[model samples]
Target: MRTLAATAAALTALLTVLAGTTGTAAAAGPTPLAPADLTGSVAVTGISLSWRQPAGGPAVASFRVYEGGAVVRRTATTSAPMQYLGVNTTHTYTVTAVSSNGVESPPSAPFTGTTWTLGMAPQCDEPAPLTVFDVTSSALSVRWSVGRASPQLALTVNGRDYGIVPGTSLRVGGLTPDTAYTIALRRANCDPRTAPVGYATTRTLPGATNATAAPRNLATTARTDRSVGLTWPAPSDGSYVHQYAVYDGAYRVATTWTPSATVTGLFHGTVHRFTVAALDVAGNESEHSPVLSLSTAACPVLPPSPSRVTATAVTASTLRLDWTLESTAGSYTVLDGDSAVATVTDPGAVLTGLAPASPHSLRVVGSLPGCPDTPASAPLTVTTLPGPTDRPVAPLGFRVAQPTVVNTYDADVPLSWTPLPGLAYRLYDGATVVGTYPGNAVTLRTRGAERHQYRLTAVNANGDESPPTAPVDVITPFLVAP
Candidate 1:
């Protein structure tokens, strides 16, 4: 009985200890569930893996992806993309869920995937068989071929990448003149370990020189007061010439890429000496061509004043004037008093439309192209005869326009009036008739510094006169007639 009691007590104590151990585990927290539905998608050199979250367990904070029993990625999302793997290879992966308290659950089932084969993956073939041609002082052309059809190749000039080239041939410019350069072509978008497929070395042609590339037949084509045109034959080595420089005596006046050029802004009636030289792409100048002489057109001069002016009455309303000049005159104008009457090309001009039986004062002036009219000749006086008996009505609206300047030696007062047909107008200076004119407007030449009262009247061919206009006062500038 004593041994049985001791055994019962020991069994009870063992049961209590077991119950306490179970309660402690329940208080700690729930265990995280492992990820489920693990799967993978394959690519050329990579695998993308994904899994579902546990449906019944403590919330997961993160997921860990395992590859070949090693943790390759730890992510909070359900998917992960793996890269940089060997082509035509296989990979296996697994995933586990992590609790908020940093506890890890059991891993999900392993998944296997295979990358694309070497033939199935994208490929870049290297360019081969390089050829160089048409090399010049500042540029060169290159071409190449490939054993198989492929994407365009990238070009390397002097170890610098120039991006992908679209065609098999390329012409490169903006290079140093007369220089050697290294060129290479390689497959584009390929592994960095791949080597270039084609390489070539070429040197540009030598630069041109004045002694070797001087232009021939440098001749002047045209000349003007402000400009000159010149043209020349291309040099023997024309392929090397890039431009031409024109020099005025010793100064460089112009530069052109063609064989001809124009020099501008020259002085009128002046002689000029010009020369031209050839320049290469390297800015090397050749010896200048033979000097060419040219002369611009002469500057214009004012026409000389007329001399020996004479007037003669031809009819009651017509007169003839003649004059001579030293230089060639383009035309001559006859002036009655200070008003221009008519213009003629020859030395003599017929002055028509004159008042009958009226005294007149006339002079001649010459004009030339591109010059001002010459000064008037000394005045000549003449009188016309009377006509049939007929009287004209009185003129109206007579007035004067101020500020009239005739010439350095004379003062002209401009006057106007309403005109009548078949009649002539006459101006009076204080009852003394100054001059008679055919038109309603007249310019009266006055002398001496004095205010004069003037009146106007209309006269017929019969020497008859109408009532005079109200007198107008005119203050003349002090001048002496010559």
Candidate 2:
């Protein structure tokens, strides 16, 4: 049934384009109104135009025959009951329904078509448009071209109306899985105002075919605060997947086939979700599988919090003190051993109202109800870390970012800092000098390591160091962008 309809559609088209040129006498308007009903049979093949009984029109000066939209020949009054069309080929033709007044009705509709021999040029209307990429899943993305000259071409896939774009791509997404599609193209010429002639067809890409590879089951396991483990069904199928995409919910997390993927620095007791997608040689990704979610145990208990954080001296009306909190106790609680202080939720506490050179003391402690309480923080007794005497100009231009940490993939790192000449950088690994370099900039490259402790100190060539700057905590994941 589909083939029959296609034949009719093709015939109606070829005939319309060729017939308007019939009879040498141009019609004043659109198609000749009477030709449509003329009784006759026409067949098209690349080589010949065959017709049965061409003698019924008025006065018949001649019978004009068309093949594939081109005039093939004109036969005089006496050619027999039927004319013999040339060799095997796909062509469509129509005959003129003429009037005795040397006028011809519009040519008859086109007929069944056949293909021509190899030596003959193709009757295709335009240069074959290139078909670009093809991707299949529920969504298919493909690009192709129709003639650049025609603005009215419409493309149909499996007889379904696909919206057209001047450029070649059709992102046919949200389609059924494992289905085949046929594409067709059509265009019309307006000067003559005719139906389209160009047509073509191609099928959707194959998915999970007997010749294609299938997914192998994968296994995942939790590792230390650093990584996770990944395993997969060996390539028993004899085909290798280029890479695997790990998923956490709808977002993809990683691409690898490694039996063990050590995921690092995840929040304690928090569950992480994961799944795997495979990449084929064609760069097509496989559908994600069932999810793999796991929660990590909390990091090893942290050392007990440091004792008493306090504001020792009130110099320049500024109070200062120091203390500690248990690192691993979910959180911390502190008391301002300095003032008639109440216990504070945060680790640091400050006090006011003091005379210059006067002294004061503070008491502090760290506690986690569920865990062991640390020894009471010792009394914090000391003068304030000196206040600035004058406006000490910054020797080098520097930037202090708010919460200065940048997130990369799964990690956070400190903002980069640059120094001016005559200025030296002192990078610390906890009060210990890791670097003392003379330069305007320091670029740190920490490959995939998610969490780290870092701090920097700027010193002038005079050897006087600036007050200790706030420490920066960086957390990040492996894998830099390409």
Candidate 3:
């Protein structure tokens, strides 16, 4: 019985010790979960790996990524990107999680990635074909096709690097004139050895020279009121002429590519002097050619003076002047007692601000473009009608005459009203005045089958017009064949 008690006590003590050890171990460090869903991708120069955070485990303090048994990266996040790897190479990666207590979990499933070759670099696949043109004395144009959108390229000219440019072409300027240059192109961030090589050399052009020969045979070809035209022969010297500069007097009027040019904005009947000089492409101008003197044509003559001038007093202070012109006139001027009373474009004008019952001398003149004032026509002498002491009585017996005949193209109708001595009558067809006459009768012609309404008014010396006569509607029949 003593030996059994001793063995039982030892067993109890051993169980207590084992339990204490287990508790201590659990407190010191927590087991972290393994990373899940490992994924990787290959880039031009490196590989990138990612994984999902393990669930149902102690919070991870950091992550570790491995590549083929080698620790490639360590981070506190679930992603790892490694670079500067061999091109066209394949790699394997795995991820693990570490707990805050410094305990590590098992690694994630292996993921493989392959680094891209230089040919797979962005915008480097099937590089653009190169071209060189616009060879000049101091500039060259280099162009290439961009196989991809937004391509960036690097260019080198005579050992000078023009850091990465965005477009597929570039113009190299400020170069030595009449000299050769070596040009090269490549893709951005690509190894010189791996990128396709393209090179060219510029050809030299002839050096520029001054233009020393003036244009010859300069003469006036045409002249007008507002412009003068000139023509000249090209310079005989070997230098190329890019343009010709024409001068009117001391002012440079125009520059033209051809030998002929017109200097505009000149005055009629004005004399102008012109000279021309030849200019080269290099901005060198030759001496001026011989001075050419030319004169614009004289101002045009005015239309003939208005004829058959007649003046009649419409009121005590107003006189109506009428005239006829041989041709159309641009404008007309009416003069009373040496002063311009009215200016009109038509042949007739009304003169106002005159004395009542007084004699006035009136004249009319016609004008045209470029001719401001024409000579005054023959004077017309007339006495204004005397002002009436009282309103005149209305005329009586207004009627249309008989025998309204239809001509080949028009109808002729005669109209008459009771005569009022010393008074003028105005005849109207609708609202338009057909005629003004001292007599009481008038005739009118109109198109066939057209209706005509006639009315008459009597005007006194004081410009007072009586009420219109009764209207008479007249329609003429169409002309019959004879």
Quality of model 3 by C-alpha lDDT: 0.61
Cα displacement (Å) at residue 152, model 2: 49
Looking at model 3, residue 430 earns an lDDT score of 50
Off by over 4 Å in 1: 1-211, 299-482
lDDT of 3 by residue, 118-212 (tens): 33444444455567776655445666654332255677888787666433445444455577788877766666565544577776466553335
Runs of candidate 3 with Cα error greater than 4 angstroms are 1-209, 300-482
- Residue 372 deviation, candidate 2, in Å? 7.6
C-alpha lDDT of all candidate models, in order: 0.63, 0.42, 0.61
Better of 2 and 3 by TM-score: 2
| Model 2 stretches astray by more than 4 angstroms | 1-218, 235-239, 258-260, 265-267, 300-343, 347-380, 383-482
State how far residue 16 of model 3 sits from its true place (Å): 99
Clashes of 1: 2
lDDT of 2 by residue, 1-482 (tens): 12455345433422111101134455343222333312222222122232222223333333455556664443322111222233342345576633334455566666544432223433335432534234454334433333224445555556766434333334433333467665555553433233334344444455542222434465665454224565666456566667655544333446666423455433233345555556655445554444456655534233234432434342322244444432323223334443443333334433322332333455555554444555555555543323233221333343333232233322223345656556676665332355766765455544233233455556554333444444555443333323
Q: Which run of 10 residues does model 2 get worst, by summed lDDT? A: 13-22
Q: After superposition, how far is residue 435 of candidate 3 from its true place, in Å?
A: 41
